[model samples]
Target: MVGAFEQALLALMIFVIMLGMGASLTPRDFYLALKRPYGLAIGVVSQYGFMPFIGFLLITFLPLPSAVAVGVLIMSCMPGGTTSNIFTYFSKGNLALSVLMTVTSTVFGVLLIPILLLIYANALDLEIPRENIIATLVLLLVPVAIGMGLRRLNANGGAVTEFMGSLLAVFFIAFILISWVPRNWEFLLTTTPATYVASIALGVCGIAIGYAFARVLRLHPRNARTVALETGIQNGPLAIAIVAFTFSGTEAQSYMAVPALYSLFIVIVATCVTFIFRRANTAAEQKMPDGLL
Candidate 1:
């Protein structure tokens, strides 16, 4: 179980992280992206649709405890992480589309997340505090709104804040390794392999499925890559914040297992995926416009 101090620290970090995500955008950015909504729509499908289903499948097949299962499902169902934008940039994917996808999924998540969790959680006969989670998700948006306000008021400040958020997303992995791993060493040692499998496979499968989904839609390779990254790279910090804020007791630690492990592994997973994407970046693809339909 997470100590009170850890829970408080988690909340504070997430607040700053979300604030950074908000700084990366303005009302104008959304207005521009809305002009071309097709790719944006695909991202939403990938996020709320494909990713959650992926989670459901993992838990269905894996023999996870109820608390651990909850963690996996929640982690899988998250919106595109701002971390995706950083990887998308390095992967030579469409950064604009990536950012738009992140924003759109987050905005829509307020409505879709509870519904999806309710449906899937019921299937597994697990209990979720839907109201608490809903409240947590809504509260998270406050930092984002503040971040957006910062952007609208001053472009330079927004850029800096955006950088900090993305940077923190990376450093958070180290935080987990340092703070969480040591404390949970015994639990990790005794954890079932299925848990680890579920954790790793969630990202791996989401990326593969997302890439395939984009190709089937006949999207441009750059856009396809963007969709794949956006789909696989879920908002880990948000999921962690949700779990930390909504649950208490031994259940809190169990609920945190997948999200914490996923957060640590995703950086490694995305790094490898980004290398492959870089290899696939053809000259023609580079010359092609970054704008997505």
Candidate 2:
């Protein structure tokens, strides 16, 4: 069973993360969303649409345990993580579009996540508590609203948001290194190859499909890259919190494994993808005249 302290810690971490997200936002951010609604629309659709189906298909075909399958589904249904914003910046993608999509997806995820989980859980014959999921998602909005209010009132709120973002990254990396990975070392060693494939494929397909859809819809090249990163980097911490709250004992541990592993793997893959995009962008700049670039 997860200890009471651990549970409380997870809750606090998620709250801080959401607060940081809201603090990062401004009134102008919403204005941008309104100004270019199509990019946001395409991103939201790609995020909530094909990703869940990909998770469903993976678990359906692979011989994964029920807990692991449900974990993957939860991760799939989550919103885009702020990590995507970093990746988008490095890739020379549309940073504003990336942030807008992240905010929009997260807000929409409050409703869409539970609905998607219900649909996929039913299809897979997995038993999940819809009420608990709904309650947890609702709780997430409280801190976010508080942070947004702070940003609206204070001119220096961006500094606080940046601090929170740094804290989140540090806390996650420290927790995983000092606690989670050591505790789950045996499970990591014994995990099946198919499970690894599924986790990696989830991130891969998210990027590919998101970019493909955006390009098909004739979005700008920068917007297409932003969509891809946003789709690929899911809110793994949120998924972890959901699993931690919803399950206990061996079940909780089992369910937690997929998201934890995916979190680590996705970073590596996203880094590689960012590098490729950076090289391509550099090459394009060289090809263009001084003023054209």
Candidate 3:
């Protein structure tokens, strides 16, 4: 019971930190979101539609236990990264699309993640705790909305936003580092070679499967790249919190580790992939004038 309480507290802290980072945006960000409706929709489709199906399919094929399978599925229900916008800008993809997608994904996550859990938990014969889902939504989405609202209301709030955002980012990272370092330290060190291999394999599979779906849907290259990264980057920290509080010491915890590792792997892959796509886009742009290629 103590472990569960600790885990919940840590998750809450991280969620708050993420929200704080988001609050630094200006009202222009919201207007920018409206400019690229198609890109936003494509991102949503990749997250809410393509990735979940791919996760379900992967879980079915893998030899993982039921708890892990459900864990994988639940992680898939999460949205694209808050930091994906930075990568998208660096890669020279459509910036408006990235921002809109991030906003949409974050909002939808408040609803979809819980519904996915309810469905998936039932499949795994696990009980659904509605309160946990509500708490998570409040912790994550509320701060984001508040930040956005502040930006809209105060034209000169950027400095304050940055201050809060930076502090929150530090808080979130510290919270995770302090708690997770102690709790999962032994597991991190003693994880079998097979476990590392499995983690990488699953991360790769998520990218490949999500990319395939995006390609099939005939999404634009920019959207395709975003989907691929989003698919690869499951919310591992969130999954860990769920395992700790809701199902500590159960088989679920072991399975949940896959998502945790996946989050780390996805960040690395996204950085690499963003550069690759950026280089390609730069080469193509150089061939054409007026940014048309």
Measured by TM-score, the strongest candidate is: 1
Per-model TM values vs. the true structure: 0.97, 0.92, 0.74
For 1-293, candidate 1 gives per-residue lDDT tens digits of: 66779778878888888999999988887897788778667878999999999999999988999899999889977899889999999998888888999999998899999999999999988899999999999999999999999999999999999889888888877878888889989999998899899889999999999999998987888888889989998999889888888888765778999999888888899999999999999887777665564
lDDT of 3 by residue, 116-212 (tens): 7676566656555657755766666666767667656774574476455545433443454565546666766765554455556655666676667
Error of 3 at 101 (Å): 1.4
C-alpha RMSD values across all candidates = 1.3, 2.9, 4.2
Name the runs in model 3 displaced over 4 angstroms.
1-13, 21-37, 124-131, 159-182, 185-198, 209-220, 241-245, 249-256, 286-293
Clashing pairs in 2: none
lDDT (tens digit, per residue) of candidate 2 on 50-88: 789889989999999888888888888889877888889
Name model 2 segments beyond 4 Å from true.
Answer: 283-293
**What range of 10 consecutive residues in model 1 has the weakest lDDT sum?**
284-293
TM-score ranking, best first: 1, 2, 3
Please state the error at residue 292 of candidate 3 in Å. 13
Q: Deviation in angstroms for 192 in model 2? A: 2.1
Estimate candidate 2's alpha-carbon lDDT, on a 0 to 1 scale: 0.80
Taking all chains together, the TM-score of candidate 1 against the true structure is 0.97
Please state the error at residue 155 of candidate 2 in Å.
2.1
Tell me which of candidates 2 and 3 scores higher on lDDT.
2
